[model samples]
Structure formats: structure tokens, C-alpha cells
Target chain A: MSHDHDHDDHHHHHDNHFSPMEARVRALETILTQKGLIDPKAIDAIVETYETKIGPRNGARVVAKAWAEPDFADWLKHDATAAIASLGYTGRQGEHMRAVFNDAETHNLVVCTLCSCYPWSVLGLPPVWYKAPAYRSRAVIDPRGVLAEFGVTLPEGRKIRVWDSTAELRYLVVPERPAGTDGLDQEALADLVTRDAMIGTGLALEPEAEA
Target chain B: MSRCETLADSPGLPVSAEGEPVFAEPWQAQAFAMTVRLHEQGVFTWAQWAEVLSREVHRPGRAVDGADYFDCWVTALSSLLSERGVASEAEQSALSDRWARAAEATPHGMPILLDNAG
Candidate 1:
């Protein structure tokens, strides 16, 4: 299915700024469009999809929700597809969902060996390393080493579970809620959930880290 | 904890229950969208594009790095454009050189202004 056409208050900010990568993108866009190879409008829609529609914010919300309610967390673990869709984050490429939880004894990490199939509705897009051949290869072969590379040091004796996602089933890691968040609400908790945490590369941020 | 259960994609109009390929870099997304839009516009059929892309990735002397997926995609598109007569190889190569020179000459934090940019 094509992207939904809600086109809400998406900010079309024009700061006349383009990073080196952005400049290269602009050059490609111009070159391709001028040669009648690509339509500017199609690029606009695709850009908007990743830029605003699907992103870490969506997954953060889901993580926060899981932390806020044990019943909801159970729903996420038992029936992630329905649990996630119930939150209104459904669309193309994000219909089937599976969420793995972090506990004192088990850690979950996601990787797609064949291709970078991700939960676009929640995580938006994966980080570069997730799609790298090394990551896809090593996540299964050497999960602990890969985690260490990301500065994540799991406790000794803790078993790491890696999820190899495919085009059929997708995964979102429900990171453990950080300590010292006693009075924090769902929104505040969401703020503490980083993309890396949801991907099992990092932990829920320390409370003091919240700005 | 173990790997999540693998499921087969639902048969349908390509929407399926699962997600599509996610782009890590913005350039990858742009390259992907450009290819998709071009296909939709009939610049070349998906079958033709797929065939050329398979050839490009499998071409002689290509790097074995998997991180080059989008890079390979872009190169394949360039090859397709040249092969289909929509753009010339020399012209695209010249354009690429022009940008590299302009980018090198531009100062930090300023726009890369090409003299011939339209």
C-alpha cells in the first residue's frame, strides 16, 4: 500500500542549509529529475515518510508505554502486532510486530542478515551499523563482542538473545526502564528511551541524562 | 531468549504484515526514492532495472562489502541511465567531477556554489 496522505502540520522548514551529504543528495535529485529519471514529488513523499512519519519517537512511545503498564507490556510480548497497531502506528512495512523484553538474565538484540528489514512504523529507519555486513554477520556469531563495540557492556552470566528479523516478522526491543524514574510519567519516560536503547545497543538513559 | 520466530510474508498487494527495507543514511533514501520514482515514470521497467542492478553488483572487480548496497544501487542506476540512452556516460562522469572540484574548493559552512548550476 502507498503511504497514507494525512500531510498534517509537517514543518517544511527552509533554512537554506544543506550538509555535505544533503548537498550530494540535492545534486543527485537535480541531476536525476532534470534527466527525467525520477519525479521530485515521489522523492518528497519518501523523504517525508522517514523524516517525520516513522522514527525513534514512535518506538520511544511504545517503550514508554510498556514501562508504564505491566499489562500493556504483557500485550507487547504476547501479541505485539495488535499491541503496536492499537497505538495507531500502523502502515506499510510495519504491520507485523514482535517485541522482546530485557530482563536481569536475558538481553535481546535485533539484526537482519539477509537484508535490513526493520519496523519502519516504530523505529523509522535503522542506524547505518545495523545494515552493515559486519553487524548482520557478527550479531549472530558474536553478539557480546558487537554489543561491546557499541559501548554496551552486559553483565557477566547474562545471556544475549539475538533476533534475526526478516520481511515477514519484525522486532522492537523493549529496553528495561532505568532506575531513579519513580515519579516520571509516560511522556517523561519516553524522553529517556533512545533509539539505540530500543535496538538493544544501549540502555534506557540515566534519569540525570534527561534534559 | 532466542531468535524470534520467522514468519512467511502474507500474500497480498506487497503491503504484507512485515516492514520494508529501512535506509540508514539520507542519501540511501534519496537514491532509493529516485530509483522507485523513475521506475514508476516508465524511464525503465522494474525488470530491466533489476537485471542491470544484479549485473552491477555482480560486475567484475566490485567490492565484496555489503555496506555498499545503496552505493551499488546508485551505480546501477547510473549504468541503466547510460545504457538506456537517457544520459551519457561521459556527461555523468563530467558532472560528478565538477561537483567534486566545487566541493573541494568551497569553504566550510558555506554553500557549494557551482558556476554552471542551474
Candidate 2:
């Protein structure tokens, strides 16, 4: 098979060479700096929040709280945005996100088939693969097969439903509360709640079993 | 977070003579990057992405509002890149200036210019 597929003439190489988004960002920075849109302190605040106090760790807290308090979990299921903000873990994409609780019978997985629409406020930006054509295409058709690629194996008889997220609604998967987490404090429970569990790819880490 | 607000208020148009508008907004790139990263991580297959993206590109009214295949391509880029914090405004400006300088330095007829909007 001759795989020298070079139909480059048909391509709009200009757009590809220098990313438009990068341009926009650069232009915005120039204008902002010129117009004094950025306060020196604002940059500090943004960097500090992202580096020190945000991301999966905060998401873990949300998960831990959900695990410990039934009422909170109920609220999360009903109104994820309010529930998240209530815990002071709110951000841009998470403003109006929804949480899908996965279980043994019905396992929910998320993908932005068209684009990477995620609950960034809670989970931060998704890792690169979430946006790839492979994941978007395969997740809907063969979730179990895709999960296996991520090293996830579901027990037999579990039905998986893939949810497509949009700008209006983002998502988090409230993984089934881990075993040995019974009566654990929020902090301890948070430790068990990992980014993978929040994404619904893997279960929350439970305490090790006795020898 | 509020970087978008700054860009929204700026001026001087979107792109240069040779520069093409890939994404309508900066966040779109971040979104696009996030999606691409997820795919790389093997959360799903490229086939799935192709199917969904084709549908998105062909969605009703998208074609009529001057939206064509290229727009879909750009939209795809926007969605993926937006999630990755692809680039910032100042950085893009520097790159554009560099490209312009390179274009100017290139011998006549050696460099081709496409996507000239005006």
C-alpha cells in the first residue's frame, strides 16, 4: 500500500502553522497590558490559585464531602454548580456543571465528542488524550473497550452510558464511595478521592485490606 | 481566568494579511487542547472523534452562516486548544511579528501567502 498521502495542497496550512488561539491570546495580552487590564496583583492571584490551591486536590475534597454526607451528595446530583460553589471550589467551566453518579448497574463516562467540554472548575483542564479523536470516537461506541485502554476493567453485566458534555453543562462522576472509608473525616475521605475517580475512569482508593 | 476579558476589549483587528483566524476566541484553543490531550491519553478512539466532529461540522445552519469545511476545522482546533492554555496574547504577537519579519526576508516568489481576507 502506497501510504505517501501528501494532499497538502488542499490543506489550509496557514491556519495550522501559527495557531489563531495563540494569536488571540497574544493580542489580548498586548491590549490588556497597554490598557492596564492586568493588575500586577491579579497575575499573582491567578498563578497562586492555579499552582497552590486548585485542580484535582480541590476536586478530591468535593468528592470526599459527597462521600461523607448523603445530603451533600443529593445536592450535588441535583445542582452540581451550587454544590461545588458551596464548597468554594467553583471556577470558569464548573460554573454550571453537572455530576453523573456512576454505579455497578449504570456506569457513566464523559467525553466532548465534538470538543473537550469539561468541568474545569472542578477538575481543571483535561489531560491531552480526552480531546483526541480516538477517545471521542471510541468512547460512545465501545466504552468498555476504551476503558481497557485506560487500564479500567468493569465487572460483567455493568451497562455503560457515555454522556456528551456541552458548554451549558459540565460533568463529574461521583464514583461509588470506596470501602473502608466508612465514617472517615472529610480530609481522609478527600485523600481517597483522586482525579481519576472524579473523572469516573477509576474507583476511589479504598484503605488496604488486612493481611 | 479574566484574560478573555482583556482580549474582548482589545483592538487592531484579529489577524494580519498572511495570518488566518483559526479560532474565534482564545478559550476555544484551550478547549481544543484539552480534547486532544484526552484523546492522546486513550480515553477514546480517533474514529469516535471523527464521527462526532463530522456531525458537528455538518450541523444545520452552520453551512449557511458562511461556515464551511474549513470553519469546522478551525472550530475543531479551537475546541481542542482552548483546554490546554495553548497560547497567550503577548506570545502570539511576538510570533506574528517574527513571521512577518521572516516573510519580508524571504526572496520574492519563494514564500507564498494564502488566506488573504482583504
Tens digits of per-residue lDDT for model 1, A121-153: 678666555655788778888999999998999
TM-score of chain B of each: 0.73, 0.37
- DockQ measured for candidate 2: 0.04
lDDT of 1 by residue, B2-117 (tens): 00110111111111133544455556677767766776677887668777777767777766655455666777777888888877767776666565556545433234555523
**Residue A126, model 1, lDDT:** 61
**RMSD per prediction, one decimal?**
19.2, 18.4
DockQ (CA atoms), all models: 0.09, 0.04
List ranges where model 1 is wrong by over 4 Å.
A1-55, A114-116, B1-28, B32-118
Give Cα-based local distance difference scores for all models. 0.69, 0.55
Alpha carbon deviation, residue A10, candidate 2 (Å): 30
